[model samples]
Target: MRLNQPRIKPLSPEGLTPEQAEILAPLGGGGVIPAGPVLNIFRTMAHAPKALKAFLTWGNYILSRKNDLPPREREIVILRTGFLCKSGYEWTQHVEIGLRCGLTQDEIVMLKTGPDAGWSPADAALIRAADELNADYFISDATWAALLTYFSEKQAMDVVFTAGQYTQVSMMLNSFGVQLDSGQTLDPDLRKA
Candidate 1:
């Protein structure tokens, strides 16, 4: 939605090179890949197979239990970062993931207003961390302290890395013009932003 057209078009699975096909093979029908359009982000990233492969490693860790943050908490940071970055693609994709992670529709909407949107103290801390990381590239002492009260060192580290990772992802999706997958809807706030 940020751009009318994609700068880098998505690659179709049928058109993949042998090496790219091998890289994507594990992501097919019953592999670790999520059930949706594989050509969305993956196709675009396939232009650089090594980068995409490395990205998947870190991405899997972040979404896996190794990150320490609960799914809901992780979604809070992701949605907030996506919103702050004004990334329609990331925002649209994460809205569904967030809901599955236990965030309510209202909570999802409230993310656009940021940490001051009447979230619990802990949730607000997570959002504030995203905002700070986006705007300042560093978390403030107060935000860091608040986060310390609720998250372990690993969770705190995951919070920073997750925000940074998605921030990078937003830049990629926006710059490359990654569109929403099938059945995904763009948030009104994303459209306006």
Candidate 2:
């Protein structure tokens, strides 16, 4: 773990209330997502007791399933959102997953900047939508309409949810200085301002 950073405090099942316990139990299961800062962050939400648990639980669902959108599209949305936030932790983690969902190294590289490096119309629209949402908490009607052709009603909602989740994640990672994986680096543009 990096010094002076938001390190993953170890996960222990003890001292948890039934409510928080039910919520946290799955996080400890490696099959779910492996024990890491991401899950640890969610676990810390338990600090707020029952009140914050609702938000935390809903967040886990939306972020993990995102069933409305296809994996490829959702991954694109997430990576672009992460890039817009200049979130090293988010970028490092998602870049690999994005590739698994068929995002090429070039596509992931293009995500670092404002959707201007010659992305396809749909891809460009996705990036622009995230930028718009980040700046305004809402996407432009034009971008929304453009995405409707490719994304379903549920997917449309998922796109926004996924974007919003990563935004929250990026803000936490950047402000908290969650270290990028040791010895691994992302694209230069992704690390660029």
Candidate 3:
């Protein structure tokens, strides 16, 4: 699949465009292009580009909201979603973000198989919920009840939003073939693990 570029790409940044740079300005003070473009490709099928842009804007709002879930828990959901979707771009990007949220090298490595990572009961349950939601579009009753023991109504809603939003990002990453930049690659050990 062709990525949205016409040049032999550099690795670290892949193909981030000026438009991408402009759109991602507020997120993490800007590093890589935000995932919006990849996500927007799908929206483009049925609407004008302007409307698609608006859709991505609101989607980013969902991602940017900082609710009760610490960065680590949130990143856990994102990381796993990326893996499931085989979204190398999203997975590589979140490996860094996941670390900032306090995931260690070993912990980040383990997130590819979050359920088997031997997380705390609550954390394990959260990962399970994410897997279920991604694979089936709805959380299982057992997982939902487990979540209730940890998160309040609003916080639970945010967790759902976080998972759903990142899953969308992952879908775009795969569909768009959004790869790591030319010189950049996902950590070798990470790729195999």
Highest TM-score model number: 1
What's model 1's overall lDDT? 0.87
TM-score of each model, paired residue for residue: 0.94, 0.72, 0.71
Backbone atom clashes (below 3 Å) for every candidate: 0, 0, 7
What lDDT tens digits, residue by residue, belong to model 3 across residues 84-125? Answer: 766666777778778877888987777776686788877787
Question: What lDDT is reached at residue 44 by model 3?
Answer: 25
As a whole number from 0 to 100, the lDDT of residue 181 in candidate 3 is: 43
Which of 1 and 2 is ahead in TM-score? 1
Better of 2 and 3 by lDDT: 2
Mind giving the per-residue lDDT tens digits that candidate 1 earns over 59-135?
88888888899999999999899989999998887887899889999999899998998999999999999999999
Candidate 2 per-residue lDDT over residues 76-108, each given as its tens digit: 888888877777667777777788778899877
Evaluate model 2: give its lDDT.
0.69
| Leading candidate by lDDT | 1
Q: What 10-residue stretch in candidate 1 is worst by lDDT?
A: 28-37
How many clashing pairs in candidate 2?
0
Error of 2 at 89 (Å): 0.9
Clashing pairs in 1: none
